[model samples]
Target: MRDEIKGIRPPSNPAAIKDALDDIARIRGRPLVYPFIGSGRGRGALVELADGSVKWDWITSIGTHFFGHGDPEMTRAVLTVASADVPIQGHLQPNGEYVEFLRAVSSIAPGRCKHVWPSMSGTMANENALKIIRQRHAPAFRVLAFENAFAGRSALMSEISGSAANKKGQPDMGQAHPVPFYDPADASSVDRTVAAMDDAFKKHPGEFCAMHVELVQGEGGFRDAPREFFQAVFERCRRERVAVWVDEIQTFGRIGEYFMLTRLGLEEWADVVTIGKMLCGSAVLFSSEYNPDPGLVSGTFAGYTAGLALGAHVIRRLRADGLIGLQGKIRALERAVSERLQVWKSDRLIRDYTAVGAMAAFTPIEPDLDSIRSMVRKIFDAGVCVYYTGHGPYRIRVLLPGGCMSTDELKEGFDIMERCL
Candidate 1:
């Protein structure tokens, strides 16, 4: 461990933490599973809790904190924007920070996705992307998405997402057309998906506007598919004249590329893309061909000024520090995690492991939801913070701090997980 985070220890004031959690539960009308509250101080991947305990924060707020906590560059970026006239930039009037953020995102975005629109969250970015695509392909309101894909939780997005639980009790929008996602374990996964696509298109000809894909499904259990799988899917979309929308909200930056499409050699297939999480602010990047008409997609708040500054800074810093590319820090950490997971799999401690760059997940020996929940709680109590994904047979997910966490620290986290297991 680094000298700064060497003081990590178990909680010394459980009573105080319980009291705070009680207050939180009262205010939110529900209780948190882990009862976590940050002390507003941390170093790299290690964060201190309000109750005087420190834990390895491997999830990084569901892949938002790319550089982890208390990063000097990130801190400097925030301080630089702290003196801005307005805290939040808006569509009607945006500051230079917004322009700079756009420039930064555009500089690293796929060449075809030239136009950029910044938003406050990934869901809003997806909403904008949806509006743009739907406007371009009017009368074709249905969207094609993969099964087990998670778009977001907005009313429209809930309809579009593959999760039935998310859309429960809500009026059906009847706009989503889900096909099976790629299954690496199945030899005919690609062919099956292609067949399903053909079936959907044949059944509802000229009714689909776009196909939304997560190159690496984050909330859907950190699963990934081979490039060939995406190539086949995108080819079918192209043949049907349906727009291809890549949702890189959780995979951006953490993946060993600025854009996952660029890394997979499928950049040309992307007509529109939505990015968020690690960017600090969310954005919709689209081709000129898919740009929406005037007054179609506008929001009141663009984003916080500091977040925009940090987003730009993160882009530049990632490039400057050589944290991207095939042989970069991100892939290095991914390799380390994969190696450990492989060993555990061999030992039958884990059933299977899936990963793409820093986003990873592994099914525990006891894969039931209740067992997985118990294991996660134990892991948290043992000084590591991780989350689970998927339904039924759950898998523990980890979003490593690729920019700030060292291999040694990652191994330490694995050790904690093993102890919990």
Candidate 2:
């Protein structure tokens, strides 16, 4: 462990932090939950803020920094690409780094996904996937999405997302239809989902083009279902001739597998998939059958040169470091965190403890949005930064940096959480 991560302490420069927060709030039109301003320096899972206080970053930028902050390997990758002639790569003229990134991702992609399209963000990748599906099955514009699914924030994606708040004030595209996700508490959960899917197909008849599966719902409180449920859903889509699109944007590298579908043994059913966050850059992977025409999907910027290099390096390191199987380091961390959470649940400190690989979440005993938000703020103030997900009964979501976070550091974070509770 590094010296800065030894322990957490109060901010030394409160006035300076307050000034910076004020400036940021004035410019952004809203105050943040915590006055967090990074000092651009970190070691392992610990980051130093502008106020000279270091905290354990359990959320890892919502799963973007899988290797944690200031990873030496990632730093070297970025530096190697810094001298590129152009800062950003584009569709018309891509550099060698772009091709390298595609090859790196392709090396791990399912055999069905033979074609790849690069994009700047997850939303763009999802947009490209939607377009390819739509073009392949024209006039069949409707989509099948889970009730609490969160695709992205683009115009089409916002409409497709299951949150009404996200689609507020925007005209309803009426393109996405909802189906209930699996509930472990219900004995007939699998059958119930299949029935709902069947009803949608019957009602819409050939109007549906694809089904979006999150595998492990990120914004939906890290909730996940068993493989049996997914197999049933995929079978229904197959019978209906509706394409299966897996959105692994948030679950890609953190789920103890390069792709969650592969882990579930459902990769063969996936026609198109989108990945991002932990990959540094986002991309859409599809089968040759769904490949779009030349003029259908094109973007000005693929991504930054350094970002592509860093993404490729992350993938390579993940494979070489033995961090990607069912018995990998990611799963080991998940088990450690789940054990601590179980103790808290038994003690009545929390409820609904849910975990998969590096992602874990639990709802507070109170189970209200305001109360959960308060708990998150308290945890951040106590030296570990975590965020909340879902509504009705929000959960405190924990996303660990699977590649670098150690067991001892993880214990320290749970100790802080216990103290806060």
Candidate 3:
């Protein structure tokens, strides 16, 4: 660690970064601590913190770095764009790169979402998507998201989320509603939940504009709605001409397919779809209807030229590499681990174990923020990188990227996690 720091050009003060974070906390009126100290080397799926610790990366820039940082091709693409981007920033500069990238992303979009409204972050992209719902259709078009489904942190997203913290200062849409999500493990629980959603539809009737969802619900503790239930939801939405939105911000790409609905066959049933985190690799994506009105939804920095170039290049590479065909490799890895590890026995504190694609999480045998943080901190210190999606006291989540972590690396991380518990 000392050598790495000493070699850095002119040296960067570690304290300065911490000081800036503290300043931001004060400015935002929040006390959130900086979770991970990014090395910024943008190399391998690993982190070497200032304290001389090594870690395997499950948080690939929150999975945006699916190919891991320092990818030669991605690096080359970034360089290629940086040189040409000076021209993309000009006023009213419409270029083919931006349009081509949009075409590639729309080609992969689920259902009827052939057009996209790109944004700087997933939060704003979602906020824009909501406007499309309210503006195009009647203001009475209700926005419905499943309870515990977190879309983003914007005010409108907060209004859709069930958390009081997010909703506290956020304004609300009078026509929005939330339904209880379904869980299949509890037998009748899924049917009962769907029954509740069915009832909700009756209450709202023709007021619904779109039904937003994160198929796997990664933020809500890696909980996936029952496949049957999802099919039912899609059917219901189609029957009523209500938009079915699959929030692929977290679940997209990680599951082999671009969206979970593709894996579950809901793409044919969906209406509006939103995707972010690896659309053009770093650029966020929110799409609905092939082409909204020119001024229907626009952002100052949305769909910047540089990001468009990267997106176009990435889509070509993904298609050429047969990435979709590699999904079986993801499922095979999960089966191999589940079968190979005897230590993964169920316990009273173990709420569940979910592994799909490169995304996986194991609920703990008695979870808490301290316990979760301690486990993750220890993992970083011990050299296996992972994340903690806090969901009560019964989850020790591990979010791995589909193409990021190799099978051997994933097994090693799991082994370390077993010891951590």
Global lDDT of each candidate = 0.88, 0.88, 0.64
Per-residue lDDT for 69-134 in model 3, tens only? 557777787677676635343215556766676678777777656666556567766766766665
How many pairs collide in each candidate, listed in order?
Answer: 0, 0, 5
lDDT for each residue of candidate 2 in 1-421, tens digit (9 for 90 to 100): 4455434454457887888899889999998877678777678888878777788988888766778888888889989989989899998999999999999998888859978888989999999999999999998999999988989999999877877788889998789988999999899999898999989888989999999989998887678999999999999999999999999999888888888998898889999999998888899999999999888998789999998887888889888999989789988988898899999989999876888888889988887888888999999999988998885678899888888988999999999999988
Could you tell me the lDDT of residue 178 within candidate 1?
85
Clashes, model 3:
5
All-Cα superposition RMSD per candidate: 1.9, 2.0, 3.7
2 or 3, greater by TM-score: 2
Residue pairs with backbone atoms closer than 3 Å in model 1 (clashes): none
